[model samples]
Target: MTSRAVPPATAAVPVQDASLGAAVRLVRVSKTFPIAEGRALTAVDAVDLELAPGSLTALVGPSGSGKSTLLHLVGAIERADSGSLTVDGLDLVTANRRALTGYRRGVGFVFQRFHLLPALTALDNVLAPVLPDRRPGFDRVERARELFDAVGLAGREAALPSRLSGGQQQRVAIARALINRPRLLLADEPTGNLDSRTGRDVLDLLLDLRTRHPMTVVLSTHDPAIADMADHKVTLLDGRLASSSAPSAD
Candidate 1:
């Protein structure tokens, strides 16, 4: 796999049970995507990962490696073919759909594409979690503003996605992901589309937020440069653990 240099220094920087704790643990996990002719595409292969509470880890790999697949497994977006996957105390491999749904709320996710609603103002997007269904008499606007402030998006709260810069839009996405105050945050190629400087800023923001509100952060990236910020980094090659080690703090 290719390892690209990170642009430069940025700065830096789970949901478990209240009692039966453990951010996440994957034991002998593997995932196989079915294909035609009784074949399968193995995306993740017997990967074992352990996440301690509030620790930040990054899964780095070239395309087609199992980083995203592993994230999906950890996020309960996909199931492992055979292995034990546990978050907090609920075993995902054996969790019922209802249990999994409840588990997911605490595991926030940010995608490569800014998934913000184009029509909704930035504030509304961030306020989604505290809507009426989740909490009665919830001040969605005020809460959204607070989050926007946290993410350094204070003024743009009233703006729509089409009016924001790439970096600004991403920051909004991050805020929205945090509306639920998740215990675990999963980000997939979060900086892929941004300029180097913007990417650096966003990364720095992530580290800063960890200090403010600690949580388990697992980010997936193919860019080695961006992966430099992670203290615990893993490399996946062809759906397997090629080299997992600590990234140099430069």
Candidate 2:
């Protein structure tokens, strides 16, 4: 089913618990895209949100809902039009590109397209994030293998994206996303391309990874099923918050 078909009520916003600490924070944030005549198209309005350390938060809304825009703001890929955003205490909205690159070393991303390299094997693709530049530690390949195994792609490590199933490719993307051992992970429509069963498996794997890796994860999906898995759900209505119900919306 397309993401739009699911029951949005299944996932609610997260409740704040001070124990986990704040992994990400946004206050009075807004984003606008410039149009002709120098007018602005508002994508996100003044919004405040947070992700607790080692928690899972889902940003849910339909297309053009600013869900992805919010995720990008946390990922440091794009700056907010105004206000402040912090990831693990690092100010991102005002950080320079060079600093953002350093900040990205602690942030991971999983795109809906499964941005894997077709020419390389799963292991190599995961390793690409940590090369002669990012990770200077010895045994990075071993680390990659560990991540591949963690994502349940052990024997398939040598397989190329073309040689793998869509779910497998997405798993490889997940593994690649973790290569940096980031404290915060942002995924845009992670299960959009998978069948229901495969998508469930992928979601399960993501939960397992979050538990094992102990990182804050924020994923934006048009799918409520994807959102339902999070400990926190941030819903957007017309680029504004519908609600935030966490801890237990139950």
Which run of 10 residues does model 1 get worst, by summed lDDT?
13-22
lDDT of 2 by residue, 1-250 (tens): 5566657865565555544433788888898899899898888899988667778888887788898888888777788978888876678878889999888787889999898988998888998888475645667888888987898888888888999999999999998888878877889988989898898899899888876777788888767777887888888977798899865635
**Model 1, position 12: C-alpha lDDT score:** 49
* Quality of model 1 by C-alpha lDDT: 0.82
> Given candidate 2, what's the lDDT at residue 170?
94
Q: What are the TM-scores, per candidate, against the unseen true structure?
A: 0.86, 0.87
**Regions of candidate 2 where Cα sits further than 4 Å from its true position:** 1-22, 133-137
Clashing pairs in 1: 6-225, 14-183
Looking at model 2, residue 146 earns an lDDT score of 91
- Could you tell me which 10 consecutive residues in candidate 2 have the lowest summed lDDT? 13-22
Clashing pairs in 2: 13-244, 13-245, 13-246, 14-245, 14-246, 15-246, 15-247
Question: What are the per-residue Cα lDDT tens digits for candidate 1 across 1-250?
Answer: 9999887685544233333223778888899998999999999988887777766788987899988889888889987889899887789998999998888888788888989899999888887665365567666676678888999878888898999999999999999888877888899889888988898888888888877877878898766777878768888988888877744545
lDDT, residue 153, model 1: 79
